[model samples]
Target: MTLNVLFAARPERWESYEPILKSEFARQGLDVALSTDHPPETVDYIIYAPNGPVQDFTAYTRCKAVMNLWAGVEQIVGNETLTQPLTRMVEEGLTGGMAEWVTGHTLRYHLEMDLDLARKPGDWSQHNPPLARDRPVTILGLGQLGQAAGQMLAGIGFPVTGWSRTQKDIEGITCLSGDEGLIEALKTAQVLVLLLPDTPATTNIINPESLALLPKGAVILNPGRGPLIDDDALLAALDLGQVAHATLDVFRTEPLPEDHPYWHHPKVTVTPHIAAETRPATAARVVAENIRRGEAGEPFLYLVDRDQGY
Candidate 1:
């Protein structure tokens, strides 16, 4: 079938995906027209990026869906002009990168590797760390990224507990959900990883009250949405030893203003939003597959439900 796909992402990204996309389409035996600018009202699917120039989707009357290249869709979801189905990027590249980064840091802290490596030769102090089974990890969100990281930790014998708004069943992980289950999950968590989406309900999810529920020397790792954690409360928790340290990969602001306390904090590790990245080569194929399904009268994969707000 012929499809009028609009590639609304930036000019820079075009070169990366153009060849790969064309090859994928040809393999699927589909006739496709790619356009940098939104076409006349007949646009069937829009390949989107929130930072791109396409804001008004109302004109694209025939558009079946807005397939986002980036996983975080909070930027474009709130637009009133958008009436089309929105699907966030779900690809192996992103999932693998997130799992690797989270697991790397979790193991680093758990093993006390940094302290042992930096110590002077004469002072071989045997400051042993607790066993993996004794250390509990509380993962917020329990979504794709969270679940993947939890499984990696669980494989190494760490007692992993996951907290989400809804209950989930996964092998080797203690999954907790809803308001009541939060406290139970937090109490046993020595390491907390934030992976929740940034909706109104999730804002400041790691406030002082929630932070207090965790073990006193808990380490906080945020590779998820920036606003899910309250900046001030995290620092306060660190001040009182409620939270021993925080490894932050996201922030409320991009470029993370020069004056931010997290930048200077001794107990904080600030990564420039590099926890996970969408690889255009792989992500474009996922986008194309969904579009193919829509064209072939098959159910779309990863279709966003606007009412649930993801």
Candidate 2:
């Protein structure tokens, strides 16, 4: 039987993903009618993006699942019209990309590479940096991306601590959860990394109270959701020397306005959200595997919990 799968993202995305998805479906021995224009009632699955054309899922009566093209589900998880099971992207490429980016920035701060890079013609200021073992790094969110980054950081000899809404038992990393755990995690975070999902509970999670918990002059790296940090509070912390520097890859606004203070802040490095991306090649394989699983009556991978809003 041919499964009708709807490619519900932008036209450009369809242009890139069409051939890859077709190859993956064929490799899995699945006959899939994959197209951008599948009738809603006939769509067996949807490869979706939050900004995709299909906003209302009410017409998709036969869709077994909606496979998100991105890791984040905050935008579509709350759609009341959609009752189908939703799965977020958790492909190897995306996870590895995040781990690499997080590890690179963590090392930069740990070694104070920026200071060396800014040396003058004759400025030979002797500065010794501590080893990774001496630096305690804390990562918010222990999901796949978080765990991958935490493990990489731990492998490099940094003491890694990971926090989440629930307890996790990953080897080589100290895992913490809940209110008390968050306090402890913050207290020891010499280099803090935010990889948490965008949820109501996580909005402004790095506000004044939380910022104060970190050791003074601590550094921050945010590659997660934009709204995770309170912009005003972070600016205050940076000015007060509570946070020495912040390398932000995500923000509340994309193409962050030219007038934004972060653009000119001495303590802030603004990166244009290039931390991690869902590579089409690996991501297509993941989407195919999930569709295959759905057809075979197997549980889908990376299923989002609606109540938790991840």
In order, the Cα lDDT scores of the candidates are 0.88, 0.95
Clash number for each model: 0, 0
| Top candidate, metric TM-score | 2
Prediction 1 global C-alpha lDDT = 0.88
User: In model 2, where do residues sit more than 4 Å from their true spots?
Assistant: none
For all predicted structures, in order, the TM-scores are 0.96, 0.98
The true-structure Cα RMSD of candidate 2 reads 1.0
Clashing pairs in 1: none
Error of 2 at 8 (Å): 1.1
True-structure lDDT of candidate 2: 0.95
